[model samples]
Target chain A: MNNSIMILIFIISTVAGYKLIKDVPSLLHTPLMSGMNAFSGITVVGAILTTASAAALHSKILGAIAIILAMINVVGGFYITDRMLGKFKSGLKDK
Target chain B: MELNIVNIVSLVIILICAADIKLMSSPKTALVGNRIGALSMLAAILFVLIYNDIITIPLLLVSLIIGAFIGILFTYKTGGVKIPQLVALFNGFGGGASLIVSFILLLEQGSNIDTFARFTAFSGAIVGGLTFSGSLIAAGKLEGIINQKPVTIKAHSMITSLLLIILLAIMIFGTVIDDYIVTFASGATVLSLLFGVIFAIRIGGADMPITISLLNSCSGLAASVCGFAVGDIILISLGAIVGASGLILTQIMCKAMNRSLWHILTGSTYRKVIDSSTETIVEIKSDGAKKEVHNYLEIVNKAKNIIIVPGYGMALSQAQEQVKLLFDYLIGKGKDVRFAIHPVAGRMPGHMNVLLAEVDIPYEYLCDIDTINPEFASTDVVIVVGACDVINPEAITAQGTPIYGMPILRVHEAKHVIVCNKDTKPGYSGVENSLYNKSNVTLLLGNAADTLAELISQLQNDLQSDTVLQD
Candidate 1:
């Protein structure tokens, strides 16, 4: 993707995400923040591609470390969010 | 862009994640939404491996396994109270990943890289570096490893401004003249880290929710810019989405506190030490402690409609379980009880809700401030558990105070008030609570858990004595 196209995608997705996330209740804001925090780990894709494409060993090593950190962020963020969301239960049977 | 397998797969995964966020609107579907998100992440990783034919890379597999193991271990051990710090730590990791990736790109591509990619990489490095360090400092504060009080060095504003100017110069000049790109990126990374520490260190405990949310946005912003450098749609779009979500949460927290984002970022958060000598001591004397407890119990027993307002101190003292027991006891006695949660109550947004939920308090009974404020007027009693600033009547009455004009729960509107706090001290904002001075207010100062325990026991003893008398 070219720079302009990439920038366009970013703008469109940001607007879409802002709209979608607005509907989330304040009750679930913590989990929502953690969930999005996990998604930020999508940088793992960059780490993987860059590491695989790099010619030098040091560059590859740095990419691998990035991959590790990003993966931890992804896994840990989702895990904690799920745990927290599971606890949000209503006592009343209906609604 | 041409339609290809990779593009199709990336689009599908992005949609899945979007649907996941959409499902989060309601808690009922949020669990499944989170699962779908994780699965989509898995799919994204798998696709990247197959598309690149790097599935056989031992280093990649090992790194992933190690990362997942550490992630699970940390998440498993982390309890509800530590969620804020854990999230901050994890956010730091994400930001660090972005910073490292951007640095790698700069080193490998050198001057040969296109100007746009170079610029994006530089921007990513700066944002990612700061996000990484800022988040770590925030986590430390939340974890109690670092002082929760704001620590501003001499000439803090001047130093911060100078650093900002230097970072801008490196970013702009490096893109134009790529010969010293590596040196510039390294310098920017170091300076950004320093700036982040300075920025975060000066923010006090009560302002954590805002700081965390902003750092969360920076992490995403870093990832998105790195995506532009690498020219990948998934990184760009998903990162942007995360970035926007964080920004929205930050705005919500700021508005809830009635403070501006700029004011918080510029280190205008409360640092005043309230002068206790001049302030009137409305707190009940120690000699009258027994009478105060008796008075609180009698009023609590007679109250039919009750509201509990919990704050960060409740979490600090691990009193939620005791609060839960109190809730159960009240419910058994047929009292209408609900929790009034301030938007900025705990260390993070929705933090109080999660803590209450952990103790099995029904989400239905937990009401936001706006929803519960008017009801306070009709309430028979308001029990404040380790909260101050949120319920401080001074927010409405006082001008020029740090908490002035801030939105607060109308605890004073209730007929009677009982505050179970550690002391009569002002809260994080350093503004004395005027509610404690009201005639209807009963200050039950001590550890919240202990105070609630004694209150429950007193109520129980009264019930036993009444039955004995009737028999």
Candidate 2:
């Protein structure tokens, strides 16, 4: 794909996301923020690519660190958000 | 064929994003939605690894296992009360990861990288650096490791502008000069990191939620640039979704506080020392006219319908358990009871809801400002538990107040009000709550847990005696 076309797609997708998320009640803002945090961990792709392509010792080390950090963001963010959402019981049963 | 597969994966990821957004709107399915979002992210990661044939199996497995183990441990061990700080730290990690990825990308490309790729890498580096450092400071403030007050450096705006200009000049010169590109990139990274700290530290505790959301957006923006640099469609789409959602969250937070983004950034919305001093005088005058009820138990027992407003103070005191006991007792007594939650209550967005939810407060019993505000008028008693600003009548009554025009719980509309707080000190915004001085208001001065415990014991004794008399 051309770089400009990719940029255009990025802008359109972002605007669409903005519209979709605009009406989220304040009750769920924390979850939304944390969910997005997990989503941002898509950088793990770049980290993996960098690690695989690394030719130098420095690049390898950096790649390793990036992968770990991004994974942590992804895993921790989702788990914590789930813990939070789990607490929002419908007043029916003790979970 | 490879391009077609990537395109299909990107479309699937976008569909996942849409599903997550829709699921997040409702409480019951939100958890499933969160899980689905996580699974999709995992699929994207696997797709990238497999399609690119970047199969350094040992290295990838080791790093992922270590990271996942630590993440699981951290998330599981940390109590719900510390969630805000945890979220902040996770955001910092995301930012740091993006920064590291961009740095490595830049190094690998060297001078042979295309201008577009170079520009994207530079942006990714700068934004990621800012998000990483800024989120750390935000976590510190929330944890009380750093001062919660806004730290004003004289001429901060001018200094920030100057630093930005210098960074731009370096980037431009580095691109043009080629030979000094590495040096310039390193310099820009350092400057960006400094800018993040400076920008974040000046925001008051009251505005921390908005700041966190903004930093989250920056991290997402950084990841999007990283995607562009690497030519990954899934990363780009996921990054854009997070970036856009985070930006909207920031706007929502600003709206909740009744302030513009610019006002928050320039640090003008924070109440200054002079303004606080003037506020003290107004508080004294209001205090003189107010009648403080000493017989809190008597008033509470007499009230038929009651509402409890929880805020940051409640979280600080860890009073949610006692609050639950009180609610149960009130319900047993046949009183109509409900909890009113402010949008920007506590240190982060949805902080109060999470706190109450942790204590098993039913979702139906918890009400937002709009739903609960009208009920306040018909309510016999209103308990302001460790909350000051959200219940402040000044938001509507007093013009020119720092918190003016902000939507509040309208607790003053109740026939009687009981304020349970540690002291008469103003709230996070440093603005005095005039609601404290109303004639119907009673100040219950003590820690929220202790005060609530006393109330619970008193109620329990009364119930026991009544049962004994009937027997």
Candidate 3:
């Protein structure tokens, strides 16, 4: 029953998410993605919270992996963001 | 679980955004984006609950109010700047978010990381990182911080191909070598970063809208990878939908400029811009056109249909409000005033729309280039405000010019043309206008803003004088 419920949630979330962004005008996608990036950071917190709360050995191990990947995601994402932002500064290469 | 306050807060924001979208008004500030984003997520969650048979009707109503307040706060704080910059800034966040989500999912999977999970995680991280960075560059360019030149070199072709191959090899071989994987992946990431920057530098500012759209597509793909990594069907589906659309836009932009996408990025195709050094030519045609231009004031009062064409000069003049003032006055007097918007007129996409919207002009008054071009044939007067290149007639006549075969505003089609150029100069394509020589076209040489203001103020006085004389 739980597995079925999970599956139903997954299917609905997929459809709902698709409905929201599927028709987003190409012009508006950048702002949409940028906003979502900030919000996506919440997932890292979610992983950490799961690690703290879960009692099962496998769950704990999964939580640890989630934490590490989350850290990498945040770090790599920010690094690239900063690098790209640097291009906009004056005295960079012409064009 | 029952629907709670957090869910409610999210729903209201989405409703507002939906309303805004239905009205076709883009959001201005990061805050509006935050609210709208919050709302979209809320709506998605609600849909999730309904699909799972989790929500009661009462819970949904309360959530809407909470979401609405948050949405209002978000929109209120950002001062609502709706432009390409806002879009780029938002996309950077989305790409970065997906990358993070995938990372968390990897950790959640722990030792149970299957082959599918590993593939998705790596793909998401790499693409997401690239999107996050690429978006920032685009934002910087739009924000007036980046170098706006095409960074071209002789060996760019060979270098790009080789680096891409190396990156692919690292992804395939490094996994077996386990310990070497991180190093290889990091190297690939670095190469990708340089590729993005160099690739961007090769495309000129005029092509930035296309670049922005392309980077957006990459971001979507990154999110899709994250979706697969986490088994999040929502992420995968939404990402794919947007990714396909972005790619189509890139294809269209490339075709418009008569260049393949790769040729545009490598800077190999347009070798002509480099061979030429442009110089200003000041030819004084002291003919009686200057005096004749001033005569336009006499007809201003009686003119029934007045069409205004705005350009970069008008943008530089920052006289959009004053232009609106002229229009408002005309409209008040029961005269028809319409805008002739050239597709590629301003520095960026929909630039004039943002400026005009800020001044509260009805969107209906603005007409596309093709729509307005035909109107000029029957129109009495076309008041061109501080524009240079897109309105030029030379593109149609001079096959030798780089802008040959490019369609432009048919300002020459009008019975009487009033052109306001800063000086005798070419536009973005570095070609002089052929319309200047036409007898019907009067060159009102001055700064666009001041000239337009003068015309409006002068017309008011003439109308007043005529009224008093009749009384």
| Best candidate according to DockQ | 1
Give interface RMSD for all predictions: 0.8, 1.5, 11.7
The runs of at least 3 residues in candidate 1 whose Cα sits more than 4 Å from the true structure, single-residue gaps closed, are: B273-294, B469-471
- Rank all candidate structures by their lDDT, best first, as comma-separated numbers: 1, 2, 3
* Interface RMSD, prediction 3: 11.7
Give the per-residue lDDT of model 1 (tens digit) for B189-282.
8998998999999988889999999999999999999999998899998999999999999999998888899889778766645444226544
Model 2's i-RMS, to one decimal, reads 1.5
The C-alpha stretches of model 3 lying farther than 4 A from their native spots are A1-95, B1-38, B43-82, B99-112, B174-179, B251-260, B268-277, B282-292, B465-471
Any residue pairs clashing in model 2, and if so which?
A: none
What is the interface RMSD, in angstroms, for predicted model 1? 0.8
RMSD after CA superposition, every candidate: 2.4, 2.6, 10.1
Superposed by TM-score, candidate 1 places the C-alpha of residue B446 at a distance from the truth, in angstroms, of: 0.2
lDDT of 2 by residue, B44-100 (tens): 888877888866567876887888888898899999989988999989888888888
Candidate 3 on B198-292: residue-level lDDT in tens? 56656566666567667766766776666566554444544554465456556645544444677665555343542352454746465665334
DockQ of each: 0.85, 0.73, 0.07
Q: Write the number of the candidate with greater lDDT, choosing between 1 and 2.
A: 1
lDDT of 3 at B381: 75
Q: How displaced is residue B269 in candidate 2, in Å? A: 4.7
